[model samples]
Target chain A: MNQRLKLFWAGVRAEFPLLIGVFPFGLIYGALALSSGLSATAAQMMSSIVFAGSSQFVTAQLVHGAAPGLVIVLTIAVVNLRHMLYSASVAPYVRNLSMRWKALLSYFLTDEAYAATIIHYEEEELTPASHWFFLGAGLSLWFTWQVSTAFGIFLGTSIPESWPLDFALPLTFIAMVVPVLKDRPVIAAALSAGLVALLAFSLPYKLGLILAALTGIIVGMLLEGKESPKEAL
Target chain B: MNIWLVMLLGGLITFGMRLSFIYLLGRFEVPETMRRALRFVPPAVLSAIVFPEVLMPSGKFDFGLDNHRFLAGIVAVLAAWWTKNTLLTILAGMAALLILQLVL
Candidate 1:
């Protein structure tokens, strides 16, 4: 096989495990989006347009609640702000690439793609082939997401309304956030955010979520700063 | 106010964020504090959302045994912590919630 194919397959192999985790999420998103009253086209388009999983889930929730368009748009912006970090992390590695290459890769920079691609770039330290690795990982995820979402939309129409699958959204989040609680700052962040969210739940347009998230972020940053002054600099 | 417009703008904002640092890499530097803060963004934001959903299912708080979401959320947290498996945690929580709702 050619070098490009080799790099692509290597990327695929590294991302396979993550893809397993992501498949269920895509399916759930599709099903929940439908249950939340989105048309099939809207549900499918969301997978491509927004492309981020958690934000897409939150968007479906806000849309279902009949939130103003601006509010939902703002929420999506805040939720996806972390991507800027990923962009920075990978920027130096791909600096030499053309603007078109940068644009294409940016479009594919979801969590799974970033995880696999960054690890590949760090490990291989390859000057250009890392781009191929990113392409492979990203295209694989993009393909899987589209197909799984379509399947979910089709399956969602058949499932009974009594199933209560919407609860899966929060459950999915619990699963995600719980494992990441590895240390004091992270735990503090989670606990503080949870408490504030409870207190602020009555806020309109889900502004409470934004406030709660900011509070947690600040608390975590402060705690972390004390431990690592270099990080504070 | 239209749903489509919301999605379109959301998509645009999302794309912009993803493009932000990459577009400005040579021209700017991300502050160290901002980078550290970004580290906490995921855990903080996710928990902020999760807590309200599990603890306050309706308009009010419910922390007692009758709160199936809270109980199931605890189960999911334990599963995630022990297994480090997202799928397993979700499945366990969903199953637990289903059972709790049926029983109570």
Candidate 2:
């Protein structure tokens, strides 16, 4: 077939593995959100409206605790701050696309979509068809998320608590990150970020994640700066 | 402070963050240092998320033998490092957690 279709399918294939992990998580979110006193309509709409998995889960938990709306909204923004880093990481690759394409892809910029798309983008130089791959990955995930949410809403209380489905999310991340840890800076970044996350995890509103990520990025950059001159010499 | 209002505002804020750099970087040039740092974003951010989720599964730090997730996470790490395969790594971790839970 054509290049666009080929690249699109490649993107979908790359994202397929993550969808398996995301589906169960979405199911749990839907069930939890409904049980957390949100109306069924609101719970279902949240899968589309907020669309960020972790934040949606947090919102559900907060709703259960009868948190004020202002607190939930603020929590969402704080939790999703990491998406800014993702936006920066991906911006250069999609810069040449139109505003319309950028807007559409931005809606699909959840963590899983970004994970798959960034890995693909890093493998090659950008081409006219590159955004098509991102669209493919993002779109497939969007579809999976909505469908899984509906299933969760339908079968609200039946999901077994015994399944360790949530563990799949971290395992998927490990699989992604370990393959890319090829150098001292990258390894240091991963280790330092992991350590800092454990240390600062009690920070409210999930700020610890953003702080840990920034610390790791700075660590990686500093190490790279020092190593660059040695390699140049 | 309606729930609908919360969702609307939250959605808009999330959309804005997702759109921020994708829109700005096209218009303005990023510095060389910032560009280099972006390469580390994935490893750093993903590790940050993963470490907390696996280590602090219940919002409290758990490092004892009772923490099956931590043990399973180490298994998954080895699986990911050795195989670099996503599906395999997830399977190994899930299996480890389930088995550990059942036995211990």
Isolated chain B TM-score per model: 0.93, 0.72
TM-score of each: 0.96, 0.73
The top-ranked prediction according to DockQ is 1
Model 2 lDDT per residue over B1-102, tens place: 899999999999999989999999957765666667777877887798789888888888998889998999999999999987766887898899999999
lDDT digits (tens) for residues A1-233 of candidate 2: 49999999988999999898788778767787877788889999988989998778768867886877887897788667768778888998988889999999999999889999999899977899998899889999999999999988888867676676556667767877898899999999999999999999887756677788889989998899889944421
Candidate-wise lDDT, in order: 0.86, 0.85
Interface RMSD of each: 1.5, 4.2
Clash count for candidate 1 is: 0
Candidate 1 structure quality by residue, lDDT tens digits, A1-233: 47788898888888889899889889989999998888889999999988899999998998788888888998998889889889989888888889998988899999889989998888886756668888889999999999889989989978788777878888777877777788889899888988898899889988998899999998888887788767452
Model 2, position A94: C-alpha lDDT score = 88
Query: Which pairs of residues collide in candidate 1?
Result: none
Q: Which stretches of candidate 1 lie over 4 Å from their true place?
A: A231-233
